[model samples]
Target: MSKDDDTTQYDGAAGGWGSVRGMLSTFREEADSPAVLRTLMRQNKPGGFMCTSCAWTKPAHPHPFEFCENGAKATLWELTSHRCTPDFFAAHTVGELKGWTDHDLERQGRLTHPMRYDAASDRYLPCSWEDAFEEIGAELAALDPRTAVFYASGHASLETAYLYALFARLYGHNNLPDSSNMCHETTSVALKAVIGAPVGTVAPDDFGQCDAIFFFGQNTGSNSPRFLHTLQECARRGVRIVTFNPVREKGLEVFVNPQHPHEMLTGDGTRISCQYHQVTAGGDIAAMLGLCKHLIAEDDRLRADGRPGVLDHGFIAEHTIGFAEFAAMARNTTWEAIEAASGLARAALLDAAGVYMAAERTIGIYGMGLTQHVHGFENVAGFVNLLLLKGNIGRPGAGISPVRGHSNVQGQRTVGITEKPELAPMDKYRELFGFEPPGETGMNTVDACEGILAGRVKAFVGLGGNFLRAIPEQAAMEQAWTALRLTVQIATKLNRSHLINGRVAFLLPCRGRAEEDVQESGPQTVTMEDSLSRIHGSFSTHEPASPHLLSELAIVAGLAKATLPPNPKVRWDDWTADYAAVRDLIEATYPDQFKDFNKRVFTPGGFHRRNTARDRIWKTGSGKAVFTTPTMLSATSIADAPGRYRLITLRSNDQFNTTIYGYSDRLRGIEGRRNVLLINPRDIERAGLADGQVVALESDAGDGTHREVAGLMVTPFDLPDGCLAGYYPELNPLVPLWLHDIHSKTPASKAVPVRIRS
Candidate 1:
């Protein structure tokens, strides 16, 4: 049968639950159960390892098992028993491997040795570490450093990211493209513009004191389950929780803590949200504007009645500027425009605003859903605007929290895995290495993809990440990757990035965070910065899977040493031998934050970094929380013709970011399939479609391309009108590479216009 036919047949015969059961059964067979349990126990413990999954902060207080479901799966995937040896590669040609699914490619398991692709044999052959490093060095040295791009994943520890950045600058390239560019770029850009730092203001303990919590575009339940515990506690304390998202997630509705013996025994779950409003895609800025306007009106009423205003007028005058301009803009925005754009009734917005204004303490939390839009930066600004109005910052139970994905993404940025131009970091490199660092602006993830496609990027070296699968515009990324002269990936397992071969491609096997790394100094511990901007130490207890495998730091240092002549001023070997030295250097570079890094990290629960926003201090040029007036009030409709639906990409409960742990999205009732599109019952009827029908969705922007998914089980859902949802990576092909936030360059992964046909 044809691929389309197979998809249709599978959808009809295998019910969603059946498919889920089958996949779970397979996962059980494939998973290394004992190793998973062992690895999970190590997470967030003193001298234990860090989670390799999302960047959700480990609790200030440690748990017996800090591993969430996705975290456990990540650990298992890393410590899999399967191995991809040279002999296995000999049997499978590169051409044949290219035809395999993403699941199949990763299922080949851990890379056993350093291997280089042989075009003549159409396979990868084993090569010695020294030979591989020499070839990599030779290729890198031949190219102008400006043309080379260095990419990092959030999985890289603080030590590895520091080394990666140092190596790139020493090699005279500032092109440090990172995973953050794709996910939380808007948070970084907007927060930095308003505050001196790019991190959130609140720590985990602040949740306990919050009277109200407002979340925009964040799915805390599936994305970060541990947060549910805090939310539950807040609910029990009569704290109000509100959400604004296109879809109502199960986790947000209610959660039964399996850890709570009483709750689990009774099968009782805590009711989460006091109010849940379905905001339209790209409508966050409008909703926020409406709230600000309502606050102003309420304040006027209070003043007219000889009562104190709802706002912290004293704080605003003392700590901020530009309030007049911001208040004017909010007051001027018409209720009609706000209602139409947000698809929220004025009454609903006012209700939410009233609750926010009445609260003694409020916390604003958000995720990628808010950042992956055209007006993402504006959305963040609006959140800050509300916080500033109420003086809800710097105190317990109040602040902004951007829920970042990945274990060490924040740490990577903390240590300089950024494309943002920094003179101090560059100067430090020059002073330490006795060479001038590149001062030119570097490429971001999007720019890197474009450069490679245009043949401007000669070499691609990824420290650790599935770049091919994670990046949007799959075709362009694939083409660019295949066209490179040399590509080197230092990773623990086989991934799609390794499949896209260049003229000379090398895959270097590396040790995972779960494994011990003993060097001349002793058993070493690496530090990671959590989502709350707290840094903690992690040490591995398990033995390395293979003695041949090198640490990510060792591999990076070897490559740098091979590529550059020995510089006695910089002790590369010393840093590699001892991770503490790396931390010392990090402390030296950023003394304002990491003073006495080793001593501070040793403190129980680690240390919280400086948060200027907590003090309501605006670090913008005008020293105020500037309210930005958007040039466009709403996103331009991509639908030129009728019957077009806005497609929002989503991740399943079984998935974490780009990594697919399993095929089932338990809450959504999707199983053994990432191809199905989720449509509301109303939308299905409006489109003259029935349940379990095959359909094709075509991009409305004249891309002239269509994707077919069959057996879609139409179910009624609380999603916005004219909006549909589907899984990402699979749907990534539809989002154009150039379609992104203008300022932050984050792909518009959440909002894409498309039309469905039966």
Candidate 2:
């Protein structure tokens, strides 16, 4: 067999010995044995550490090594034995590092010591912490506040996020651009409009109680494997799970939890989905409209029969308004339009609707696939309408759940890490800090890139992320970053963001959450809030890679102290020295939610901030769950030319967000490289294309940009006729910058119109 064929042999099995062997290889090359292991133990415990993975809820039922493949990779990557010492920096030029792959640059290991770009040497030279801070302070203070931007990754702890927010407010700029803008900003925007909150209504435990699950856009088995266990259990209980996505994910079809020893040993994987429907890319609105229309029709029939109304009439009467208009709109919407637009047969949709209506309790879970669209906010709102129609919110078995991608993304947003202006948060800050915060809304990730490219932004300070690769329009993002006066990064390892250096760039080495964080007080613990609004403590099992590395909290405080006017009243140093004090401030700031924050964190599972949705109470202006009338009735497909297909981006099993763990995606039959596109056999024939044919896909949006990718062995599957799919970051350039939701400003990364050229 060829090397590629051998690699494909491991695709979508139990991944037992092969996975262990792969992990061993990764660890052997970059083992975190001594110092790193000692530091890792101090993270996410009651005075401990945080997980470096996505912001999913920490498992309430403790399992040994409660980590996913991506989580394990993230943890190991941080605690790697390899060190990027001053000597290593001296040996490699910034230009040389730029040529490296994402894995190659990170494999060089943990960054040690503060390094500043030396233009003359064309490489980074070790600089003292004090000197680095002094230079950073000088550059930041010199620039107009509006011209400076502070971007944060979700990897940052709450303490660090708080300090960063405080510093940005104090510096007189609310340009607190973050990764959330690129992903779930739509969920936040839509939830706020309909529910008066920006968080999910359901907890992890709610999954156990749900009679059925309606999954939209999210691929749980790969993107969030931990969820597979719950899904598997739900399936065992005979609860149906209906999935709607542009691509049919194999994991969703079948999932075997490796954590379950019995199941793993027996090789008995649970079949997850009762039914899977491949809706057209950007066709969520149509599907939702169809469901709503069916529900409304059912309600009328049930009322006529003298049965209990299908609609939650009592709940609607007491808790919500605007149902009359919304119901009228749903009833008027034609099935022909819904079927034609969604690209699903009317029979298939009605069958799915029957399952939904039959279930007494249902939960709707979505991810970036639903949110990263032109009408993402509307899609979310539509889901809310379906749930509200059945009185699903504020209950044990039903509600909306938007799965967050980053480890502490929810926590970051909870503590004011947003570009959107909030009067309440700003007022509170003013009351506490005695400084008027920036009133104007700041730039998001997309806007930040545009701002930097236009020369409107001068400086960029990223708190732990690979920004250049994360943002769309790679060339423009890189050029804009290089044009900056100063770019400061607080991170564990080298990434593409570090290579795009400014005139005065400082790569500040910081301790990862998996490493022990020791301060003057003692070993410290960080808290992270999960998707379910439950706060959990994380403790690291490893030691610090180097003594010189600083915690994100300490780094933020150090920067603040260096730049801010020296004041006895601020007590910035005290908060930095002891994170417990920072937690105290957080507790004080949100007394209603985080009361006794330090004490509650000691609990194994931690505490949950109560969600009003749990009780079916609508927090909207009318004190009821409201259904939004969509301005458009169908999936807004871009005008494609002859022989063109709409392509959507996907994440492989080995990757998490923008962080690629390995080139092999065993589940999808992809191996060696991320160059192949998943195309329908009919599309292949329609375009006169064959397997292994290298083709350039031209953007149908008139951007004139093209993506070159090789064809794969076409698998005839149940996808929409005109749709094609491929991996992201490689394909992000195909998505136009302007193609985004008006309400959320999240780019339509899931659905970009394109036509293949042989």
- Which candidate leads the pack in TM-score? 2
Which 10 consecutive residues of model 2 have the lowest summed lDDT? 1-10
Which digits, one per residue and each the tens of the lDDT, describe model 1 over residues 1-758?
11131121121211123323533454474565566557667777666788787777776577675655666667777777778788889899888887876777777777888999888988889999999999999999999988899999888888889888888888887789888998898888988887656889998889888899999999876688767777888999999998888887767777776566676556567888888999888888889888889998889889999999999888788766678888888888899999988889999999899789889899999998788877678878778888888888667889889999888888898887877666237666665667887677888999988898789998999988888888877876786677788899988877777888889899999999988899889988888888898888888877677878989988988999889878887677999899899998898777888988888775666688877777666677877665565544454335324797777889987777776766766665555677677776667778887756667666665665543334344434446888888887777777777777777888887877777766
C-alpha lDDT (0 to 100) for residue 533 of candidate 1? 88
* Model 2, CA-based lDDT: 0.78
Per-candidate TM equals 0.94, 0.94
lDDT string for model 2 (1-758, tens) is 12232122233443333345445555566674655444433333343455677776665455555555666666677777788999998898988888888878887888989999898888999999999998899889888988999999988877789879888878878888788888899998899789877889888778889999999999776676667767888999999999998877766887667667776677667788899999988888889888888878988998999998677788777777778999898888888888877888878888898998899999999998789888888889988888888888877889899998888888888887887776237767766777778888888887888898899999999998888887667765776677889999898888888888889999999988777777888888788788888887766646677989988998888888888887554678788778899888788777887899988875665688867766666566876677788878544446646766777888877777777778867666666777666676667777777666676666677666644444444333345788887777777767777788888788888877777766
Which whole-number lDDT from 0 to 100 does residue 319 have in model 2? 74
N/CA/C clash count, model 2: 49
lDDT of all predictions:
0.79, 0.78
Q: What's model 1's overall lDDT?
A: 0.79
